[model samples]
Target: MSFIRPEVRAMFLRWREALVGAAILLLGLYWSFGVTPGLLSWVGYLALIIGAILLFAGVQRGRARMGGGGPGVVQIVERRIGYFGPLNGGLVDLEAVTSISLDPTEHPRHWIITHEGGPALHVPINAEGADVLFDAFSSLPGLSPGRVASTLKHEGTAPIVLWRRPDLEKRIARLH
Candidate 1:
């Protein structure tokens, strides 16, 4: 039994990080501007810095959620990426992925994972439990998790390869 409405609660969950960031930023700004000229000012400055960091991180996280629009949840466990969506869901081994790319043309950008002789795995960026992918994807050679995450928000019209296995990379290099 709860007083909160379901839709309102869902919206809160969706933007919780950004909301927290906004709260922190507001507190910092209030303290920095409202307080007297003393040691508290220094504290206010620290808070401001922390708040700014949170705001930036939170905004990015919110964007991730917005971009990851999909029916199912995404989970990363033991280096396997699992999707439990309404119409489709499956698991893929991170270690077995030969190439990773960001398909920016999609509505909520998708992280495309390709493996030898297997259909590409499409993982929505905002899928629940997708955050865990940072570490899992970081383990792939030549892949930068930070770069991958940063690109997730970009609404590019073309697909960008985040990482490629040495064989594929060399083949492409040779073609040039």
Candidate 2:
């Protein structure tokens, strides 16, 4: 038995980033006034910057969930991600993934996981258990967690490539 409903759980995941930012901002205020005052009051600015970044992340996350959810539930276990969507879905190995892209212009937004010699798998951002992906993708080298959340609100019609295998990037560079 679980204390939190799945829907509520998902909702929390969706807004968690923003909530974190708010907390940081509050801490900054306390640091400025309570912990360090006068000359060190400027320290609060650090919190403000961090809070803004976190708040932005939260906004983008909320944007991704604008449509409630599409036709899928994602599962991540032992470095493998499985997506079950209505029309199409499949599993992909985290290590074998070539790149992860965010297609924000889509109806509900999607995370396109790509692999060499295989068609990409599309996972809706608002799908149940989609929150697991944040941790999974965070493990990748040279990938920024803030950037991952920020790209959820990318302002473009085309898909935004969030991260690519170093080898893939080199290969693309060679092709050019």
Candidate 3:
């Protein structure tokens, strides 16, 4: 029997990375300012930097995560993202993606990933394995993780374009 309630456990699981990062940050603080000396102090400084980065990334991932169990399953393989949902689903290649947008007008927000020569794939934010999209989206060229996280957390009714391929932007500008 577990003492922790299921809801509490699930919450912890969702923020596990941030929790770990916080712990590391604490350890680094203690080592840097507490009783550690010389080389250990320097190491502690390094740890501080690493901890801060991890914490930032963790917070971003945590914000992006929508607790799953919404609808559909998301899979990313070989840089391709595939969404399998009851009503709608599609596959999007990360490399060929031209734009990524968030449609907050939906019941549960949906990520509209548009790729070259294909229909846009609409993946629900809370879909199972959707958290993995954080890493996948981060790997896209010139995409900013901070911007993505901020956009994901924004409470807006209109659709927001999160990222666009730089080359595509230049091409469209040239044509206009």
What is candidate 2's lDDT per residue for 71-96, written digit by digit as tens? 78889989999999888999998999
Candidate 3, which segments miss by more than 4 Å at Cα?
Answer: none
Please give the lDDT score for candidate 1: 0.73
Against the unseen true structure, what C-alpha lDDT does each candidate score?
Answer: 0.73, 0.81, 0.88
Residue-wise C-alpha lDDT for candidate 1, range 11-110, written one tens digit per residue: 7876686688778777877777898778777777787888788777666555444423455687887878887867667788776788888898875667
Best by TM-score: 3
Whole-model alpha-carbon lDDT for candidate 2: 0.81
TM-scores, each model vs. reference: 0.64, 0.66, 0.92
Q: Is candidate 2 or candidate 3 better by TM-score?
A: 3
TM-score of model 1 (CA atoms): 0.64
Q: Write the per-residue lDDT of candidate 3 for residues 1-176, one digit (tens) a residue.
A: 99999999988988888888888888888889996488878878888888888888888887777888989999999998999999989888888899999999998899999998888899989999998998998998888777778888788978899888998899989999
Tell me, by lDDT, which candidate is best. 3
Runs with alpha carbons beyond 4 Å of true place in candidate 1 = 67-72, 84-90, 93-96, 102-110, 116-118, 124-170
Worst 10 residues of 3 by lDDT: 35-44
Cα RMSD, each candidate: 4.4, 5.5, 1.6
What's the true lDDT of residue 78 in model 1?
82
